[model samples]
Target: MRPLTPGDVRIAACREGDLVALDRHLPSPSHPRRYTRQLAGLGTLLVAWDGGQPVGHCEVRWDGCAAAEVRGVVGDCPEVNGLFVWPESLRRHGIGTALITTAEDLVRDRSGPRIGLGVKDGNTRAAALYVRLGYRPAVPRYLDRWSYVDQDGRMHDNADPCAFLVKELG
Candidate 1:
């Protein structure tokens, strides 16, 4: 796939119908229903469409896994979680940045001084992107990883060694 230009991307609030794309991005086919439910539990879910196709997504949770993980570290900050870019080929084209930026806009609308997110420890590319976008390592060196149940109510572990980061909304 050719690299996408910023002008060709549209980032917007996620609709319930986005469950299709969300499911496709999940590790297995059985994960979307539960994922959709979780996204609904969030304060906001932002999706990036590239030339009208769903390419990436991010979400802001006011009181979910993200908040629970950084409760004291970021002190009540809304968290940007579940950021994903699909197909692996659609990456490195600013779609992730657009999704995160949209998530930050949601945080700003809520009048937050800062927004928080977690990056898996070994994921240097993602960590670099967060740093370049103004996020810094939060007080806690690590936080509990994310896990969720599938449609069948079976729990799935997505555990990773992660670093919590916060960005001042200036």
Candidate 2:
């Protein structure tokens, strides 16, 4: 597991190329532009590489507020967002945990006491992964209430609801 800087060779700053990689791995291109813009404004975007190929990526942001805010939901804490590991790379090693740990450390360096993220309801695997990493549910589970249509002509509503999970940085 190697750590990559923003413009490193294997993990160049997430430009159009990395966006292609991300689209291929994610369930849909629901918010790639939004995520790209966020990555541009946020501190750093970390991508993991296997043999010099981009394999996984995560984004970390510092809330200008003394508190954290995700999708307009604000809290008195720092947060991490847009963490995704390529499906093809799951379980081959500890890449996902490494990414999360890196995000935690970055937030901690900023004097953040806690970090938080929201996981879609039904993504049990991701939720479980967070739990195993010491994150616990911190906000009431609620329906997302937003909707989008995917490339497959399928509609998904944030209505599926999500649990906001948080981890205290020590």
Go through the candidates in order and give each one's C-alpha lDDT. 0.73, 0.63
Tens-place lDDT digits, model 1, residues 40-138: 664666778876577777767766344354675566677787788886887887788888887788778865778888878688999999999999987
Q: Looking at model 2, how many pairs of residues clash?
A: 0
Worst 10 residues of 1 by lDDT: 26-35
- Report the error of model 2 at residue 56, Å: 1.4
CA deviation > 4 Å runs, candidate 2: 1-40, 64-76, 145-157
**What would the C-alpha RMSD of candidate 2 be, to one decimal place?**
5.7
| Candidate 1: Cα lDDT at 77 | 78
Q: State the TM-score for model 1.
A: 0.80
RMSD, model 1, all Cα superposed?
Answer: 3.2
